[model samples]
Target: MYQFPKGFLWGAATSAPQSEGAALKDGKSPTTWDKWFEMEPELFYDQVGPENTSNTYELYKEDVANMKAMNLNSFRTSIAWSRLLPDGKNLNPKAVAFYRDYFQELVDNGVEPIINLFHFDMPWWLMEKGGWEARESVDHFAYYASVAFEQFGDIVKKWATFNEPLVHIECGYYGDAHWPKVHDFKRAIQVGYHTLLAHAKAVAAFRESKYNDGQISIILNLSPVYPRSQEPADLEAAKWADHIYIRSFLDCAVKGDFADEFVALLKEADLAPVTEAGDREIFLNNTVDFVGCNYYQPMRVQAPEVAKRPISDPHDLFAPYDWPEKRINPHRGWEIYPRGIYDIAMRLKESYDNIPWYISENGMGVSEEERFENLDGIIEDDYRIEFIEDHLAELHRAIEAGSPCFGYHLWTFADCWSWLNAYKNRYGYYRVDIKDGFKRTPKQSSFWMADVIAKNGFSREQI
Candidate 1:
């Protein structure tokens, strides 16, 4: 039998724009997502936009009831910055009342709320002011974080400054997946640097405020890098890949600065971003209280076929190699390597002083929902159950080996809406039917997860 520690947190996570509809209601302003959808509706799957999602703004009470029914003791969700500050400088009274009631409901249902400040939904006004690329945006973000602490600090004790900062840097500044897409490597570095600075400033503010004895951290999507073979060139490639993708943020968040080797490489390439006088001191003074890691898969890297050129784009530094023998998720086309999670946990234990971490987001997203529906009007989702079980077993091994992991939150609670994928891939314990007034029905995995929560762990015999 597998047994986790007492009071271990078991729950699910969701972002605001993906689940909460009513984009313009209750004095809410438009975010980058709202503007992006308006500009290019066809970019989204099925042409579904953020204007009408799961209507969580109107149905949060029902959603909290569903969380309690699932035996979840903790729930992680983000407050929309656009909803709270319509003008990006002033707080809306109606939005404050809404969150106060929403957070209180979770507490009333005996569910602990883990509040995150930013989750990729930047207010439109902030984007107009040059977004994260501009250094002043960092100060604005810190001020916004202070306002959130003062407003909701009494009820919420656990806070994450940003959810997946790397995702924003890579997708928005380097790739075309997110809004304000700019494909300049130098700009990407600048944006990433400012984001880390904002996180540190907010952490320093949190410590000074002493609000509810809270802990502040940043959630990172940390995937271990592996060399394609034992060759020295391939191994060297993996090191650079780790520096560019993982360590760029990990070192700053944990060690309070970038690695010297990486800094030298950046200097060599003439790709260093602009840094002010006291920024290093700020990062050094305000380290994270804990770390939130979101692991989904491992990255495989190999030596480039030819000599590398000067920095043209963010991905030009290293190349990703797909191993033919790796197991792939048929529905999502993503590599499924459960051992990667264990590697991440152990590495944290050994490398970064283990500083207390948790799996903030990990789950499977499958397309073609009708194939999984059963005659009982429920999604069988046995594949998803197996997927989660295999990962959890590895996590259990990590815990037994003394990794300071105290919680595991799945990618989401309900299959609401994706950014560009829309509802093409669903990753929720409860299936949401947008056609039927956004009705939610529990999938088989929901009941199975409820059992796992009740038992605190699962046995191989049970599976």
Candidate 2:
């Protein structure tokens, strides 16, 4: 058995909106997600509306109890922006009191709290005003972050400014998949830049706050970038994909500069991310204390003859309607190349000084046939166990190679709510019966994770 260092973090993650159903209560304003559910209910699977979620707002005690049962020594969850500041400006007293109590429960249970500020939840008020694309939203976001830190910083010390910023930029701005469904690359690029700026500003704000043990970070969903072959053109395309997809924000946030090659690429394409006065310095100087990486899969790229294209540019080189090249896992339809985790880890170690870091998320999604067949008990999750073990094995390699790795936290503890999938693509350890008043039950993989965390390593031969 491979042993993890003492005091490693072992737990699961969830967010307020995904788990807490009382969406319209707690003085919460409509988030962009809430609005999405209402405006285009068809976009959601089965048109599952968002009125009632996991109800964590009313069930923190039971959730915490679930954590204890999981043998979790640590837990990660995001605070809903609209919940605390209903209109995205003023603080609601009950909201603050509720979260304070929620966080305190974790502390009381010896569960280390890793609090993320934003997890793809945007206040509808902000979106109505053009969301992150407009400069005003940046300032408004800074204010909202400051408010969150001011109100909750006392109990929640470990904080993340944003979760998977690129996904938001890609899904929200450049693609019509996520909310605000605006498909403008220029807006996407600008919003991407501003998101980084917002992260830096939030980090600065958190530093200024008087929270004990306060640490600020940004969570990136990093996939290992791969070239299909050693051909020169293929390698070039691979590097380009890696730069725009992974390195851009990471270099700026962790290493204090945009990658020179990516910057040159941007310049050559006449697509340098527009920067405001002092934005570069804010990013350069306000490096995050840690990196929270959400590793899922890797990108396998082959050079295509799309010449007028800026590879990795949000602008579609392929027709806007066509999907790009990547191996899709037939089982779940996600690109399931496992080496991405290793490559992502090594990239961070090689380029970003290997800052203290943790794996914030890594999980697999499966069709709901198992659920319909009444086959989703904790014991039947071997595929998930295998998926996690594969990534962790790579992480073990990175750690041995001297990456400043801390620990790992799976995407969720028990079956919690996903944003668009509603209760469909359940990524939880303890499965929550969505119809049973959000009742919780452990999947077999959850118990496997407990053993994995307890033992720290699994081998290929073991399979």
Positional deviation of residue 60's Cα in model 1 after best superposition, in angstroms: 0.9
Which clashing pairs does model 1 show? none
Per-residue accuracy of model 2 over 45-103 as CA lDDT, tens digit each: 77776677777777789989878766788888888888888887688998889888989
lDDT agreement with native, every candidate: 0.89, 0.77
TM-score of model 2 (CA atoms): 0.92
Tell me the tens digit of each residue's lDDT in model 1 across 1-463.
8899999999889988888899988899999999999999999888999997988888889989999999999889999999888887889999899889999999999889999999999888989988999999889888888889999999999999999999988899878999888888888888988999999999987887749397888999999999999888888888888998888888899989889988887777787889999999999998888888898888998887764756555455557899999989888889999998899999888889987999999999999877879899999988888989999999999999999899999988888788899898889998889999889899998999999999998887765
In candidate 1, which residue ranges exceed 4 Å CA deviation? 210-212
Superposed on all Cα atoms, the candidates' RMSDs to the truth, in angstroms, are 1.2, 3.0
Point to the candidate with the largest TM-score. 1
